[model samples]
Target: MTAVPQERRIVTAIPGPKSQELQARRLSTVAGGVGSVLPVFTARAGGGIIEDIDGNRMIDFGSGIAVTSVGASAEAVVRRASAQLADFTHTCFMVTPYEGYVEVCEALAELTPGDHAKKSALFNSGAEAVENAVKIARSYTKRQAVVVFDHGYHGRTNLTMALTSKNMPYKQGFGPFAPEVYRVPVAYGYRWPTGAENCGPEAAAQAIDQISKQIGAENVAAIIIEPVLGEGGFIEPAKGFLPAIVKFANDNGIVFVADEIQSGFCRTGQWFACEDEGIVPDLITTAKGIAGGLPLAAVTGRAEMMDSVHGGGLGGTYGGNPVACAGALGSIETMKELDLNAAAKKIESIMKTRLTAMQEKYDIIGDIRGRGAMIAIELVKDPVSKTPFPEAAGALAKACHAEGVLVLTCGTYGNVLRFLPPIVIGEDLLNEGLDVIEAAFAGI
Candidate 1:
């Protein structure tokens, strides 16, 4: 494989000459509600570097929101997708099945967390995969209620909005959310009601007890959770919390789902985050990095459960598009060949070392946490008090962007700076990104 670019080149101010002109045009052509993380417009990206229209190169720390795991514009992904395009683009799997679709499903069945007799279905996005998973669960269990955790973000669809916990953006103005969805507490140790150190199995048990009493476990169709909470600050569940929830779901005959949308595909040093705890979920929903930036999502689960839905009940016009499946196959192959799990671990080592040093130097960094390359630093006004420093997070991210590094901020309170470098990122480029972060924090 070719090496990643080693340096970041900043030729102009961040929304450089060309990008500023495009940004103004975009404001008129696109909806004002649409947002941009960094003002720079990309001309090209490969490995860990994103080259902008102004000829400036920035180190990419946010891998397209944890997609593009093999690196942006991966050669293998581009080659396979191009080859598949030469043959055909889409026949719609629902209309005419193809080998690429079957091949992608076969790979998913073999690689997902569980070893049970598994089957897979592809969808066009993470939201669709989530919605379909609920449909299948409700059909198989013959139950109406589906339970999702607080701080968990499923998608933007009406059904998924009901499943999601955030109020703004996704839920705002999208009222009258789909019925039969219930919300429960997630194992967020940082802000857990019981206190961080004490919020393990007991907190989870409390939440489960509430669900069993309030929603009645018998009426629940499925209990869905992110093995590591994405978008909601990358909160990893406390040690015993996940297994406890799984036990509860099993005892109550409720389907257990793991939302690995952002944490799967070796982003968390494992194929799936649930593997960290050795807990096999009944249904695994994945997207983001699965296809190396193509819009492909999947729900892989027990054969019988997946077969519960009627044939025509689970498909989209663009579900499992041949080109996307081809990309997925190539991305998975690249992941295995490159040992991206090991790469994620290496990223974790670098991040932990650098972030720990930052924590010692800057009191604004309240907490440093996450698994593997999927790490984050929570900013706070008072480190001892743990009060979120939203302004500081925003300022720090802006500074990093100005200095030619791209970083993303996420959290319920919007005070967390997340690092989602591609697993294939080079050591020199990764360190360069870290240096920019250090410089940004130093100014604060």
Candidate 2:
């Protein structure tokens, strides 16, 4: 499935005959809690299109929730991982370590921001990496309180669930969560209470004030946030906001951790979204796009901070599985060779133009924001009210699906249509997906 048939083709209605059959089976076996945005069952996915079991092709805009920047089955990744699979599957690195894992650490040291000496620890998922990061920070700083921002999404693990801000699906009834996690305001420009101009300084000051007054910086071990808030509506923290927060963390000896799980790996026009602001965090957590489509995550940070955790304190039975390490190396190679950072920038250029036009045409599109290919349009009920229109977002997503274009809805308010196309997609295919989006809006 390295290369899909390429064009978007609709052989049947969305969730076509085979997909409908699969859905019936899925309902029987799958938990009701688990959900899919679209019911179309994927047969194969590569390039810009996902081929469904019933021979339908849909443009891929979700990128498997920003995990497959190199395509679901990139040629290089498949080649490298296949070779590794043939040699061996898993050898529990703790028992007998392998070169691929070390090589990955070396790559991380070189590629991650901050030229300072750095080291990395691998994990099996973003939540695991994030939880480990908190552990490392607490170990190094000897503090208990962890500060996170409003609208921030960490993960679903208990500790991460406590760190995450959303309530409905991610948090509901999942309480008895970890204690000492504090929430602060984020500098979201579009919906800023005091307007965009004041969002940066005002919001940063408010957060700092909150930490100082309520949380008390002395009790905080770390301040964790997504460089560009993902799942919480792709909110890019206003300019000067992150740096201000970083400075506060530095002054208070609080570890500034950038959770780049969804925004790293060239998904945000740069190697990592934090790089866009030149903010060098004490630690960074990454996962979604790191291993092509394999489950792998890592916490990379200052050598001193990571080393403070001590041996046996930061490993898992399956962490850094050799095959996943191979895939990560392959994904990194693909990113470097393809210059996917530049590709992400190209995606932004194309997406911004069309999305801006869509914004002009539709009053419902209140704000169009994001960097690189990780862009989104905020849906509103009307231009004057700026009232979130989750219904419109849902309607548009359903419309796009009917037209053979795969789109995703996100946002704290659930009124945002986020787009995350693979960096490897052809420009024509990208625009075709946009065309479907435009038509979806038009129909609405």
TM-score of each: 0.98, 0.99
* Candidate 1 local distance difference test against the native: 0.90
Model 1: number of clashes? Answer: 0
- Taking the tens digit of each residue's C-alpha lDDT, what string does model 1 give over 41-93? 88888788888999899998999999988988888899999999999999999
Model 2: per-residue lDDT, tens digit, 1-444?
436878989989888999999899999999999989898889999988899999999889999999999998898889889999999998898889989999999999998999999999999999999999999999999999999999999999999999999998899997899999999999999989879989999999999999999989999999999999999999999999999999999998999999999999999989999998899999999999999999999999999999998788999999999899999999999999999999999999999999998888889999999999899999999977889999999999999989988889889999999999998989999999999899989998
TM-score for predicted model 2 compared with the true structure: 0.99
For each predicted model, how many residue pairs clash, with residues at least 3 apart or on different chains? 0, 0
lDDT of each: 0.90, 0.93
Candidate 2 clashes between residue pairs 3 or more apart in a chain or in different chains? none
After superposition, the stretches of candidate 1 with alpha carbons farther than 4 Å from their true spots are 1-6
Q: CA lDDT of 128 in candidate 1? A: 92
Residue 255 error for model 2, in Å?
A: 0.4
Worst 10 residues of 1 by lDDT: 1-10
**Model 1 error, position 27 (Å):** 1.3
